[model samples]
Target: MQSYWNFPAAAGGTINSINNAGIETFKGNELDSLTREICQNSLDAIKDESKPVVVEFKSFKLQRNQFPQRAELLEAFNKCETTWKGKNPKSEQFIDQAKYILNEQEIPFLRISDFNTKGLEGAQTGELGSPWSSLVREAGSSNKGDSSGGSFGIGKSAPFANSKLRILFYSSQDLSDYQSHIGVANIMSFEKQPGQITLGTGYFTNNENSNAIPGLINLDPGFNREETGTDIFVSAFEPKDMNWVEAIRNSVIYNFFITIWQNKLVVKVDDEVISHENIGSFIAQLDDTNEDYRHVKNYFRLLTSEDSIQIPYPAKSYKKIGKFEEGEATLFIMKGEDLNRRVLMTRKAGMRLFEQNRISGSISFTGILIITGKHMNQVFKKMENPAHTLWEPSRFEEAPKEADTAFKDLRRFVRETVQQTFQAETTDTMDAFGLSDFLPDTTTVDGEGDDKKESLTLKIKSIAQKKKEKPKKKLKKKQRNEEFEDTLADAGIIPEGDQAGHSDEEREEGLGLGGGTGNTHGEQGPSDEGTGGAQEGKGEKEKNKPIDVEKRYVCLQKNEGLYRVNIKPEKKFEKGKLEFKVSGEQSDYILPILDVQSPDIQVISIDKNVVRFINLTGKKLKNIKVKVDYEQYCVMEVDLYEI
Candidate 1:
């Protein structure tokens, strides 16, 4: 069959945008997206239970004639060069690769093959919701089911971005048709120029066949005729990052470990093979210093029963349901190495939201919280943004109001769990609010015991005012007012001169500062004003002054020589930066060092025995950790609070 290169409608500037779209989907790490995207597609292609899915990545040198549709592909390459110069003004590699693919006898190519899977199969109608339609003919149309990992169908851009020639060949054996289909597409930025134009995204296929669409062929020498699978060949493949091969391997093993462990998939990179049997050894290649490695390793070990840790649902009482009864949470904690503090949270599918790290406080322990039940799935799913990185309830405010309530309950549950796990009895201030006193009957009443029966019941009552009769001794208006004033003067109802006629009861209720009356009862006291001052005297002038404005902190001695420092930001400073100095008084301790807990706060330096830092976080309050070091092998706790 005579082959011809068919190009799609070259919309003005549309190809430019599409060329950049795939690259933008994976901005930071190209290899991460590459591994994730290709692997996801392979998993979705799995249609056989008896045979395992095997994906292979291989590099080989192939002669130009070996390619089945070399003539049409060369035509496509020649056409790609017409506008390549204008598109990539400085990229000589583009011209070199294009010329090499067309003129050279031999070229290097990357072949990524997936075995024992249903290859891209569907009627080639250029229609939506078809694997063949989307993979070969469409750009962003998706045919993925709900359980599929990819949704946008833009993941193919990763491989295209990695290809030096911006051309990739798709060869797959449709199990139902029992026929192999070979196609090639070059997605790149192109300058629109008359009849020579093509939407950088087009197919290289048979031209003689009347039923043929763009970018399709019937055969290829590289196609595995004995097996049903797909092979994606990248002509002139080269990665910008030098260490991409190793990095991609590690990423693949780390990300697909769950699939590997279940014996569902196997990956081969060049000569080395990665499968469930040897997945652990492959994972060891990842940087051990990274918290990600530790998390994955520990998680895998936990699943395989290799680690010594026990995590159970929190005692039933710890799980609280809000008024909606929509969600409940349980915390599982363990004592392990003080690495990264993370709380692994999962939804109904058991896929954890990795970016959402709920752990607070120091990295002294590990915790895992499984918050699920009732309407939580609807709430969490609705809350998940496109990235699936967070459960931001605010993003879903337009959703049902119930979802907002459920989201709030989830947050409260997380906060309370974190406090219970980390802070312990440090919540005395919250307990001081006397909130429990307002709650309904918590304890059962005993009818037998008289004391238990005499529980307190608060009641609200209305009091009536009494009418007073006219005084027997009548006098003029001035005399009557004077008489009332004399009576009030004796009773100390009003202030007299600077002495401030405050009764003993009023004095007791005043500022409570030494002997002075704090504030009169049923009157506007200094405490009632917006400021900290009273309505009378100096208190009135100083009204609106904040209470507890002094800077105060509490230091808790953790170990014998270590202490945790907490600064009260709300009570002292609210805006701008704050500076504090900590000096060691002990003669034995020289050059005392303080280790900062949070990256948001910067620690300037430590000179001699003093440690200084400025609060970089503008938040109203923060808990800053200042670790005081003593002489080597010495046992003593430096008093930071006293200093």
Candidate 2:
């Protein structure tokens, strides 16, 4: 039995001196988290498509005499304690637990086994790049592919974190050759002893030599059959003052709810089996039906079936990034439940990028978004952190250029689509959104029609009180034209035939978005608002240049009636002077406004043609009318567009 105790060591510091932070990752809601972590590993290890993975949890009480080399093991345990004490004479917590597990003849253990999949197959030791090496021998050695759910192999440390004695045994059978392997390891605090350094992690096997093999079990005799899989035995797993069974079962059903729904994994605890057969019953155990659970279910429905939670409006778009084999991404959004609003981002492989409490809102201001791309790996690979808990491009500055683009494009698309969908659903009247003015096939926002992309800026304003707008007199064509001309003049836009013009120095100073001079588009800038300004050139050339079909800006209003939406560019604002500039050339744009019909507010006239922003600039500010009686809310979406 002493020969079976083949411990694996860590580098830089002994395993005894292992950092608690690494182990702390597995310390949340013990049983629930442990079940999720372990199940994820088993799922990732699946080798045969024809067979479903099977996991079993069993606990047993054994007598001291059950050990094959009890005396030799006791001697080794004594030596381990002596060495541990020499390293850390001050700390007794780890040593005390070790003494209990080794000195006690009647110790209990918990065993979890996975069947019908590739077991931990590969070299037992000395080489890298194997599941055995990553899972049992190395910390943070994750050889999992892109599709694998476990981001870092650190998840394997979960079992040790849950064990009272921090001791675990591994026994696996290679499915291909039906060969057996076994090993034992212990996770302990870092301690140093002269010439007696203990890594705390060790392997156990029946091999006559020192090398630890993965297959030979010291006690269980029935695991060597041809069927392949791995089994983990945990020693002294009784936690203080908690019902481990119930907690473990609930956590399994909660965290793996989606996996269980797919019918790929089954978990058993003693005589009680938890699988698809009882998934619903387990879900019933939750108090609020859990938003995360609902999110997963809704996503599955959208993924497998076309049926989705419907929205009354039609301001949504479907887009794709990269031409990966995983297929294009389709985006559909609508008004959803007031709470738990989220963007359900999922991979084709069915792993959702779950960031809890990600989106926040309330009542009329709240919205839900669902985003799915079959070839999501191309985008997500660049967005994930080592923990795989959050996804953001800013998280990866050193990533490849294409990956960064995918991240930016995907984020923009999701943001624009959700804002449009929310405002569309919330508005009561189609006239408010000017929906009747545009053809059904016309693009409601930029990027709806062509591949040309625009960097978009988002600003959402929610009014707390319901303000009534009195019907206003409609402006004549001449008055509207004058207002547009005045706005351009404020931004230093000279008319095509007008003689008066700003000096060349003034023109250069105003040749960018928000009126600052320089090349802005597609270049690194001092700010995030990529230059929305046009190029400065010869006066005649600048005036005669065709409207860059790609430079259009679009705003979506709930109703055709214009509500004051003030969009302030982040840069170059001095005093009250506005510097944002848009080219003064004719272009095409759509302003779809949805205004919910309210009996208290009178109806007003609406614009019925394409609106251009060539005359619009940051200098013009629209004042919002407020009623003393109610809080007025205005939500507007601004996107750079090319017509």
lDDT of 1 at 343: 53
Q: Global lDDT of each model? A: 0.51, 0.48
lDDT tens per residue, model 1, 267-367: 88777788989988776666778767877675555446533343333322112322323234444444345433445555433334552232343323445
**Among these predicted structures, which one has the highest lDDT?**
1
lDDT of 2 by residue, 309-334 (tens): 33322222223333543224555443
Model 1 Cα shift for residue 153 (angstroms): 1.9
Model 1 CA lDDT for position 305: 51
TM values, all candidates? 0.58, 0.58
Off by over 4 Å in 1: 10-19, 48-52, 80-93, 123-126, 174-177, 189-196, 207-225, 241-245, 306-334, 344-353, 367-643
Whole-model alpha-carbon lDDT for candidate 2:
0.48
